[model samples]
Target: MTYPRTRGLPTTRRTGQAPRAGTGSGFLFVMATLSCVIALAGTYYFFVRTTTGQYIDESALVEAATLNGPAERASTQFLDWLPVISVVIAAVVVLFVTIMRRRWKAAGIALVACVAANLATQLLKDWFPDRPFRGVQTIELNSLPSGHTTLAASAAAAVFLVVSPRWRPLAGFLGGTFAVAAGVSTLVNQWHRPADVVAAFLVVGAVMLPAGWLVLRTGNRWNVQDGRGDHWASSRLWALLSAMAGIASAAVAVYSLIRIAPGFGQENSTTNYFWAGVSLIVIAGYLATVAATWLFGVSARRRHAL
Candidate 1:
């Protein structure tokens, strides 16, 4: 079916067409915003009304450290690797889209949005420094707005925008799941309060939703244009850059896992399970990229043959 063409943009033989808007954008924006605001409010209550910000005293830290033993180590290891995995996934999505569509602009915009979400999280943390700990205590700044969650969610949203409509729901679900998992893990490990995760979600959603909308809208506009499109001079350069980003993110995840749980790298253990999961995810991502490339290639060839 032919879609409506948007007016005022530069027209190519293929330009001016606009696709039907998807429902995902509105749904994601509303749900993400609601979840984040609720989390922030809860955090505010804890910090203002209680001593949640106080650090465990030295003696308490030593005692708890001793009692928790390997469990603490395991939790730390998981958290460290989790962010790395999220980042790698995001990078892979960016690279896949760029290579298949030669849409470097969209990929760059996604990367920037991810970075901005993290930055926004940090700024919010500093702005609201009220911890809400519930144990033997010393005093320090509160850790509201979890950066890990923000980055994961923002990256997911950005990537979702560029995917084919048929794949969007699955992409969005995976992205949201990763973000939630990262946030929940932080809380479980005592690295972040419940409130912190909520705040992070809010900050990430606020930044990503609007940014995603604009990027997708522009991309749709471009896709409508007809011609031997002007290919960007640095298309290959961008692809390589995206691959590098993916590699770097994977490395970071490995480093984080090692730092959090040194034993995680040991052979034939639950740590292996985590590593295996990440590897599978990476493999799946690459396969998807290959498929997308093949499909795009086939379509291009058919058009030429016609």
Candidate 2:
């Protein structure tokens, strides 16, 4: 029952004790969910309540709108096709899991998670209080969660959830990149603000983390894959890429936010804020993806040992 160590991921220590059911991933899921909720709440507070938040949003809109006309038009066109692209990707992943991997239970859990995330997005968008005027020229309604971003992120998350642990790292990195690109496209098209995109990432992660555990809880055998020798999809390069991207994007976001703090009300330059928003989306998307990869990777190894 020994698992070949693959790519520096965690493996079970030689102990004579049995592992508890749901201990590994269950804790991870709860923590991940709570973090997402906290993020959503904080995003709402800053984006809706604070004057600086309003200014940031206004600046983002203006900056996004000021892109070159051809680039803007192309972004809009790309965003319009995003839903279709997401659906196609999700379908391909789900089919691959169900047919090649024969992971019916995992596929079901992934789909349910996908539906729940999108439904939660609609519910939050409708029931969340409208944004106060805040003396900003932005839209009045609460667009805390971007529906397009939610669709894209959740779809990518579904694909990530159903894949085998050996493949999760690569799946996570690629899926996260796709989701982030979709979110940035929305911003470039001026279809949604930065907080909205970040919120969407949180929402998807909140729902998918638990669903991932559920998939593992029921499909332990299928979750156990040969991690020793495999394709690029099972390599650690994706983990490295995701970690580096997350760290770099987070640094940029923190630096940009700090720099823009004292200059908010002075000059009317939003380029910094715009870059900050994009950086936030990158951090959110990649961090969440890597977290999932680690969480489920541990869960799979632990369950396999048991």
Candidate 3:
């Protein structure tokens, strides 16, 4: 079956030369992946290895546990199943898109990204040295990038990548929300800290951005879809909402951090840091989603131009 190509991408004008759809997208993907790697390393250094970061992370864990009760217990019961649910949903979505659109290349790219992201998470967890006894009584082994968060984020990202551009903004918004929730739930359960979740977001982005560009580079025709005023999922409203939510969360986190700065190490209350960490996770997740959606959209347009 011949896959319908998007008219937006340009082919050879007269000489019938092979398409160069990958040119601009290839550069963008490289830059984006490098940026994510830098972000991940920086997060590991500042949050996982440093004294201040450990204090804050430990404090948040304490606060999160304290905040955990009947409501939290109920939440964990459901959250524990998120990885399985995410995998199932992502598998169904990826298979459907691959079969319906006959986008075998896209399917393979998504699968590779998912596996690479998760594998990277586990490797980082084991390879990174334990944190020095930073005056904080906590486990020494580094848990900077969380496994569960990676699972959720990568799965959600795979689905986002497989879907047509028209559906991405909505998928990004909803998928970001799900991933963030799963990250935050880990916090509530005292399984991982906020920075861990944030790092997970970066890892998934690092892996997915390149994979997404590959899809655009290979499946350009099927990847590009009419997004303007098409469906609710394709609307700009979702993008706007995601941006608003990210901005708001960042502002709140800054304010919380400022308030806690005065008593940074001496404070007994975990409330401020807990919320602040959660805010950072929210900001990272939504912003990454928005960036991914925008990258694919721009890459598609540029491919058409080439």
Candidate 4:
């Protein structure tokens, strides 16, 4: 027996079912997950293991402490209720998708991954040693993989997972921004260091990438769509905007550090390091968003198997 060919995708004579789009999205996702893990490890080592990393991190935190007034007040308020707010938003979005779209398996996978990411973060916090006194006049508490950041990023990842393909680009962008806001807020209020927030983002990415792959595989009925042009939200504009923002933030971070390099060895800073740290959080959040958006966008089926 033989199967008719469709869209240049070859099918096995025995099974007669062509692979999903003949794309290497699964390989890309696995590579992306490994990259996330490696990035997390590097972040932890540099920030917690080395004296130079410690100084830069401490400098950023100390400079942030000097910032006050309306922005600080707003960040504090946002963090004070971050847990409740994140949970409510995630729950509502997940419930609506599962009930309305009937994405039972995908929803279960997403929710499970979300809980797992948060739990892993807490465990890491407990397991990691306190910040060693490498000549930096900072606190000794181990704050890597910030809990607040994990909550926000994982909540956003959950919503991103259950949404249909057409909305993923927009959902990813909005979700990334929310997570970035939570991270920057934590830094502004001294709740966490820059590395801690970035580590949290990596943790969510590492967990959700695999879960998202599962979602694409199982939710094929709804995941199939007419591509990005089919919906305004799925427009390539969202990913482009995110990439542009990430690039701009990266440039600012490098420039800030460069300007302050000549003034280094001094014991004081002028908010340069703090802005750099904030820029890092922004870069990581949006980088993950754009990567996930592109990965899912390509990995999802363009049309159902005939």
Which candidate number has the best lDDT? 4
lDDT of 1 by residue, 1-306 (tens): 443435643322353333322223444445545655665576456543455322211222223333256666766787888778777888888888889878787677767877888887888777775544466453457566667767766777667656643344346445555665565455445565444555666676566655555564456433322323334421233334334434654675465346435465543233332332232223223222222223322332232222
Tell me the tens digit of each residue's lDDT in model 4 across 222-290. 665543375789888999999999999999998788767865542345898998899999999999999
Candidates sorted by lDDT, best first: 4, 3, 2, 1
TM-score of each: 0.54, 0.87, 0.90, 0.90
As for candidate 3, its clashing pairs are: 6-221, 9-304
Between candidates 1 and 4, which one is better according to lDDT? 4
User: TM-score of predicted model 1?
Assistant: 0.54
lDDT of 3 by residue, 1-306 (tens): 333343544344443333455666777789889999999999888877789878888888888877847858966886779878888989999999999888888899999999999999999889889888878899887887899999999999999988877788888999999898889888988889888998999999888988888777777465544435467777878888889999999898887788787665434455888888889889888888788878877876555444
Off by over 4 Å in 4: 1-23, 263-267, 301-306
Candidates 2 and 3 compared by lDDT, better number: 3
The regions of model 2 sitting more than 4 angstroms off are 1-23, 225-231, 258-267
Arranged by TM-score, best first: 4, 3, 2, 1
Which residue pairs show backbone clashes in model 2?
none
Off by over 4 Å in 1: 1-73, 131-139, 221-306
lDDT at 70 for candidate 2? 84
| Model with the higher TM-score, candidate 1 or 2 | 2
